[model samples]
Target: MCGIIGIYGNPEAARMAALGMFAEQHRGQESCGLAVSDGKVIHLYKSMGLVKEVFTDEVLKTLPGYIAVGHVRYPTKGAATKFNTQPHLVETLFGPSYALASNGDLVNYDQIRARLEAENVYFNSDNDGELLVKYLAWQIIAKNKDVVEAIRCLMKDIKGAYSCVFCTRKELYMFRDPLSIRPMIWGKNINGDVVVASESCVLDILDVNGRSEVPAAGIIEVNADGVKVIGNNPAQYRQQNHHSYCVFEHIYFSRPDSYHFGENVFEVREDIGRKLAEQDKGLEADCVVPVPDSANFMAVGYSAASGIPLSLGLIRNHYIGRTFIKPEQTIRDESVRQKFNVLPNFFKGKKVVLVDDSIVRGTTIRKIVRMIKLAGAEEIHLRIGSPAICYSCYYGIDTPHREELAANRYSLEEIKERIGVNSLKYLDMNSLRECLKEPDEYCYACFDGKYPLEKE
Candidate 1:
């Protein structure tokens, strides 16, 4: 997935947009970009790297304006390269150039690209962002529709999740898909300039929380005039039926410190851990050991619920970046070890409940279980924070197919054997629903296999 932000009316909008993106870097670590408009023309900069690494002073300083939009992206629809990075700018019939950044996958991208290509249009990159821009430009150019109407029409052609922010020289706008599979929130800044972003952390980081947050899966447009909502007709999309938010965001993608869809990810994870503890009631675990990073919050919940001390038995190397490619199998195995180091003293002779976010292809967890054994942990029991991932996500996440999933391929007992754990306890799907006060409000498609959007 990705993160998008926009600001209008503030003179230092470009800087504000940068701040928003900096807060949103965790959502996507592959590339970052920004576009600013001074109520005239648009200026742009994008690079394939982290937000801090890509948008340095030289890049950020180059963008000057009272209005700006930015994006931090990870490649789901295209390859990781500067060519595919976003804040894609193109002038529309409306006036100055408009830049767009998206936060989710569109399953219909292949169909849309093929349909457009047949009409004598050539493309520069195999990027979904490019295809979206081409479609919007074509709609405004070919159909003579206004930007909003063009967007409305174009969205009808898109399939899957999207929580996006768009900006022209004049206005800042935000939107999410009918299902709102992704998270996008907006608040007002101290200057009364609107702040629209994918995470509330942007508002927290920028001190822009006066305005609570925008409604999900709808349009939020802010200009010098004011902010307004549009295309909020739930009936329109519901008439066709496409709705399911991604539950994985709360489990892994989003930072526990952030807020989205009115649910605190940290709290939800804690609830997941408590529920996991409930399922494995009275388990004899000496301490809870989190699989550094993703499972930290859940570990705390398990520790509190089970009355076991939480220990940092495993430490993560912060320098292991989001993008790392290994040319050999041996190197790949070594890379996992480098990312995590077991504290021999902390884990030695302990009955450890290893808290991990989720198990996918099975190899990593299997290897990690072996590693902990070598670390002298007396007994290794596994507790997963999220329900066993039995499906692959066609969305932004890098998940393997259902058949390839460890859970899908093996029974509970078999999985425990494969992972070499004393026992494996997974949070049940029903337990997941109970954790969320409102089940319909949340999407458990991955667990229940309820495909909201039509498949490609």
Candidate 2:
């Protein structure tokens, strides 16, 4: 998944959007961008770094706008690079350029890209979001219609989930995929500036009034006049609590400090550890140690409930940027190892209750377990916060193939043997539901293989 934000009616809308992007940076750290409208034209700036690193003072000065949209990207399909970092801008044949910042994937991108390319449409990037804009822009140009109508028509052709925002010189348009696989929220700052973002924690940082989340698979547009729904078909945007919101958003990507899908991530993750402890009665794990940054919060909860002390067993190399994004197996493996260094001092003479967010292919998790064993950890009891991922995420998560999924192929005992862990315990699905105060509201499709939205 990615992080996106938009603001209208602010003198420094680009700056404001950048700030919001920063707050949601945990949702995506690959690339960051900001594009803003100054009433005359759209100015754009983006790069391959975190918000603070990419939006230095000089970069911010170049973007002038009172209407702005920004994005922090975690590539699901495209390469994460300066070449792909969005707020992708397109100059329309009829009007000034517009910028789009998207936060989810489109399953039909391949088909659509082929259609446009067959018709000789020049594609600037292979990014799914950029392709979407190209299709919309081409339609707008061909039909001589407003971008909104073009987007509405464009929706008929796309077949994947998305919660996206686009900004023109005078307007901000926002929409979610009919399935609403991703979460997008909107609010207003104290200054009456309209804002939209992926999570409410960003709104808290901006002192914005946390309005209710926009409806799933719905459309809303904001300008100087404020927010309003413009378009959506009842069949596609059917309102229901299907609850297919991406589980990874809570288990991993989103900050533990945020709230989404009607549950506080921090609280749910804590409950995950508590529940895991309750289920795994006789584990011989010595100390609770996190797998690094994302697991730190849940590990704390595990430690408190398990009567074990928490320690940093893995030290992350924070400076390791996307230097190894090649779509190859060996490179990805080497990248994960390079990004983390086992802390022998932390694991010395200790049996570890290793807390991690989620286990996908179990590649990194397995490697981490091996690292702990190499570090002289006497025994390893691996605990996970979320239910086992047994299915592929058609939404936005980068889950491995189902055949390769650890939980799908191997039982907990089998997985423990494969990883050489003393014991392994994953949270029970029902127990995970109980962890959430609003159990029925959020989607657990990844765990249960229940898709919330139908494909067109």
Candidate 3:
């Protein structure tokens, strides 16, 4: 997954995009970039680092423009390198130059790239973002189509999740895949400047008003004329069975404070914990302890439902970036040691109910459980807020291989034994659906292997 933002008609467009990227740093940490259009030229800057490290005040000053697009990349489809960093710029020989940044993965990327390569189109990076821009550029420059027609063609040809933002010399364009698997929202600031982001939290950060989602299978344009829906062809863009919005957004990917799919993430997570408590009705524990950060709200709900007090058994070091987003397994393992620490005397001789978002590889949680046991805790009962992730995600998330996922490789009892936990319970799939406002609208492919798009 990645974070993308576009700012239009703002004097400090680049600066505003920087702030929005900072707010969404949690979504990605491997690299960050921004492209600004001054109505004449598109200036680009990108680097492999955190948002704050990449976009300093001096750097922002260099990107002078009235419209800008930014991206924080997590490397779902390519290696973590400067070449893979986004806000990918494409210079068209016959049409206006444009930059594109997207938040989802394409399952048919290899086929598309091969077709483009056969047409003599060269590639700079292995990333899907570059392929997407090249495809759009091909339609615009080679096929003599406008931006709207190019996007419509993209919607028809691309087969995966993509919530994208594109910026030209004069306009900003945003569109989501037929399923709307990833989140995208648009609003207007007090000055009537249009803002679009992967999440509503950025709109709140910018004090934008009338925050509204870009329609599923929709294309929108923002310019001096204001925000307008260019197209909304749900019938042509719709997936087979349902909308297939990514459920992981509510369970873990999104910020608890953010709202997506007409439901508050924090509330849904809390309800998930309550449901887990209902499942484990006879569980015995001295205190409910969250794994920290993402699981804090779920632990809160578990505490309230189980009539147990909440305690900060694990203290997170917020200075470090999230370990899961780190590209290398070695870095992820090392960061886990530095990212969280056991609170002294908190779990001593106590039975602790450890609440965490979900277990993917199970490496980090295994280490965490070991730390808790070493801290003199009598027992560690692992409670996951989401259902077991038994399958890989094709729509933008980093879970690319089934073998890498612990749940996919082992049974529940085996998982508990492997993690060295006294007991382990994942929220049931039915319970997870019950917590959502529109249960049938989500894609539970990662949990249940029901992919919205056919495997490539």
Candidate 4:
């Protein structure tokens, strides 16, 4: 998953995009970039680092424009290098005419890229965002298709999740895949400048008005005239009759304060916790201790439902990024050690109920359980807020291989033994669905192995 932002009609478009990207820094940490158009040329700058470190005030000053597109990348399709970082820009005979940044993984990337290559189109990077821009540029420049029509063709041809922000020298366009697997919301800020982002929190930070999801297979264009919404019929592109948003967004990916997929993220997490508590009817514990940050709300609901006092027994180092999103296992293991610490004398002689969003590799949770154990906790009854991830996610998340997931490899009892917990339980699939308003509209392929769009 990644974060994308677009700003139009704002003189400080680059600065505003930087703030929005900073708000969404949690979505990605590997690298970030921005493309700003001053109505003449699109200036592009990107680097492999945190948003705050890369887009400093001095760096933002170099980019002046009334239109901007920005991205924060968590690598899923390509190697973790500068070459794969987005917002990918394409220049033509008329100079830099298009820059595109997207949040999603393409299943038919190789097939489409080969088709383009067969037509004599070249590529600079293996990143899917680059392929998207090149595809549109090919259609607009070579086949002479309108920009909106080119996006429609893309929706029908590409098979996967993509919430995109595409900008030209004079206009900005936002679009999403047919299933709406990833979140993309847009509205006008108080300044009346049009803004689009991967999450509502970015729109909140910018004080946007009338914010709404960029519709499924829908395209919104912002230019000198005004904003125009192209509400495309998604059924034309896919066989699925319902939207397939990623359920993990509510469980782990999104910030609790951010709202998307027609539900409040934090509320859904709390509901998950309550559902988890409902599953443990007879269990007793001294305190409910949650893995900090993401699982904070779940613990709140769990404590409330189970009548257990919530304890902040673990302290997290905010300086370290999310361990789950780290590209390599070695890096993730190291991050788990550096990211969390036990509170002084908090867990001593206590029967603790530990809460976490979900277990992917099981490495991070094992270390955390070990830390609490060494701190003198008498028992740790681990509760997962979502169902066991038995399959890999292809749309946007980094669970690329089934063997890499703990649940896919081990039985429930085996996972409990491996994590060194007294008891382990995950929120069942039906219980998890109860936490959402429109559960059927979401994707649980990571848990159920029912892929909405097969890889081409």
Candidate 5:
């Protein structure tokens, strides 16, 4: 998954995009990029680093423009290199023209790339965002299709999750996949300049008070003609009757302050915690401790419901990025060691209920459990917010191989033994659905192995 940002009609568009991308740094950490249009040409700057590291004040000043599109990438489709970094720019004889940045992965990447190559379309990166921009450029340049028409055709043919921000030298466009598997929200700041991002928290930081989701298969364009919102009939593109919004976003990826899919992200997490507490009616624990950051609110609900006092026993290192989002196993393992620590004098002889969002490979949590055990906790009763992630994700997550998943490799009892936890309980599938407003509208493919879309 990645975070995308776009700005229109703002002179300091690049600076605004930088601030917005900073807010979404949690979504991606491997690379960050920006494409700014001064209404004459598009200026591009990207590097393999965090948003703050790459887009310094001096760097933002160099990219002065009224329209900007930015991306924070967590590699899923390609290697974590500067070549795969996005805000992929395409130039023509006229000058540098179109630039696009996107969040989400394409299921038919290989098939579509092969088709484009057959038409003599050259590629520079294996990134899905590059494939998307190239496909649109092909339609617009070769077939003479308008941007809207090309995006419509894209929805019809490209199968997967994509929330994109595309821009010409003079205009900005935003669009989402037919299933709306990812979050994309847009609004205007107090200056009436339009802004779009992967999360509502970005809008909040930009002082955009009134925001709305870019509809499923919907397109939004901003130019001198003014803002236009275009909706698409999902039935025309996807076979699924209801939108298969990614349920995992609420469970883990997005920030607690963000809202999407008609539900507050933190609220959903809290409900998951409450349900988890309900499941453990007679269980006793001295205190409820969250894994910090993502599970902070979940632990709050669990503590309130279970009548166990909440303790900030585990302190996370804000400097360290999320371990789960780290691209490689070695990097993830190293991050787990540096990311968290038990508070001094805490967890000593105490029975702790450890609340975590979900376990993917189980490596991070296992190491965390060992830390608490070493810290002298009498017992660690692990409570997971979501159901077991048995199936690998094909949409945008890095869990592309089933062999890497904990649930796929081990049973619940085996998992408990491996993690060295006193007891283990994952929130059941039915309980998880009860946490969402429109349960049927969300995708639970990772938990249930019922995929909404498949790799072609």
Candidate 6:
């Protein structure tokens, strides 16, 4: 997964984009990039590091423009190399320049890239965002189509979850797939500058006005004329089945303060915790302790419902990025070690209910459980806020293969034994659906393996 933002009609577009990227730093951390269009030229700057590290004052000053696009890379479809870093820019022979940044993975990227290569479209990197920009450039420059027409054609040809923002010297564009598997929202600032980003949190941070979601299967364009929705054929773009917005965004990915799919992310997680308490009604514990950060709200609900006092048993290092966003397993493991520390005083001689978002590989949680045990917790009850992630996600989340997921490999009892926890429970699907505003509209592919896209 990645974070993408576009700024239009603002003289300090690069600065605003930098702020937006900073607000979304949690979404990605391997690398960050920015591309700014000064009406005469598009200046690009990117490096492997955090957003703050990559966009120092000196770097931002160099990227002067009234239109800008930014990206934070997490390396889902390509290696964590400089070549794969984004805000991918494409220049045509006729002098038109376009830069693109995206937030989701493409299922048919290989097929599309092969076809483009056969037609003599050279490629610089394996990054899906690069392929996407190239495809758009091909349609607009080679096929002689307008931006809207090219995107409409693209919607018909491309298959996967892509919530993207594209910018040119004169205009900005944003779009999401029919399923809306990833989030993208747009709004205008008080200064009449239009902005689009992967989450509403960016809009809030940037103080954008009239913020609203970019319509699913829809294209939004912002130019000198202001914001306009452009699509000649709406019926063709309409989703045939139930919309499959990724439910995991609520469970873990999104910021608590952000709203997506008509629900507050923190509220949904709190509700999940409440339902978890309802399901495991008779369980007894001295206190409810969240794994920290993402699961904090969930544990609050669990504490409120179960009538157990909440305690900060695990203290997170705010300096460390999320372990899950790290590219390699070894790095993730090292990050986990540095990410949290157990509060021995809180756990000593206490029976605690340990609340966490979800367990993917079971490695991190197992280590956490051991730490709590070492702190003198008599009984450690693991309560997960989401269902077991048994399948890999093709829609941008970095879930491991089915066989690598702990749930897919072991039974509940076996898992409990492996994690060295006294007991374990995950939120049931019924409870999960009950907590959401529109359960039918959400995707549970990782938990249930019901992909919205047709399987190859």
Report the lDDT tens digits of candidate 2 across residue range 304-358.
7878777776888875543222244576688788888886577778877888878
Query: How do these models rank on lDDT, best leading?
Result: 5, 4, 3, 6, 2, 1
Candidate 6 lDDT over 1-456, as tens digits, reads: 789999999899999999999999989999999999999888999999998888999999999999999999888888999999998999766589999999999888999999899888999999999989999999988899998888888888888889998988888899888778888889888888899998999999888869888887789988888789864443465455567899989988889999989999999999999998998789989999999789999999999999999999899998999887788889988988998998757788999999999999888898889888988999999999999989999889887467878999999999999999999999999999999999999989999887887534
Error of 5 at 112 (Å): 0.2
Error of 4 at 431 (Å): 0.5
lDDT of 1 by residue, 1-456 (tens): 788887877777778888888887767777888888887878888887777777777777778888888898876777777888897877646654768888788778888999889875567777777777777777777778877787776667777777777776787777777777788777776778778788787888888866454544477778766878874665465444444667888887787888876689899989888888888777887889888787898998888898989998887887664322222336446668777778756767889999988877666677778888998889999988777777667766655257757777888899998789998888888888877755666666566566666559
Q: Residues 97-194, candidate 3: write the lDDT tens digits.
A: 98999999999998989999998899999998898888998998889898889999998888898989998899999988888899998988898988
Model 6, which residues run further than 4 Å from truth?
231-239
TM-score of each: 0.92, 0.88, 0.98, 0.99, 0.99, 0.98
What local lDDT score does residue 210 receive in model 4, on the 0 to 100 scale?
86
Candidate 2 wrongly placed segments (more than 4 Å): 81-83, 117-120, 144-147, 229-241, 312-317, 320-346, 408-411, 438-443, 453-456
Each prediction's Cα lDDT score?
A: 0.76, 0.77, 0.90, 0.94, 0.95, 0.89
Error of 4 at 204 (Å): 0.9
lDDT by residue (tens digit), candidate 4, 318-366: 9999999999999999998899999998999999999999999999999
Where does candidate 6 have its weakest 10-residue lDDT segment? 231-240
lDDT of 3: 0.90
Q: Which candidate do you rate higher for TM-score, 2 or 5?
A: 5
* Preferred candidate (lDDT higher): 4 or 6: 4
Higher-ranked by TM-score: 4 or 6? 4
Model 1 ranges off by over 4 Å: 91-96, 239-243, 322-335
Task: Itemize residue pairs with steric clashes in candidate 5.
Answer: none
Which model, 2 or 4, shows the larger lDDT? 4
Task: Provide the lowest-lDDT 10-residue window in model 1.
Answer: 320-329
Q: What's the lDDT for residue 406 in model 5?
A: 97
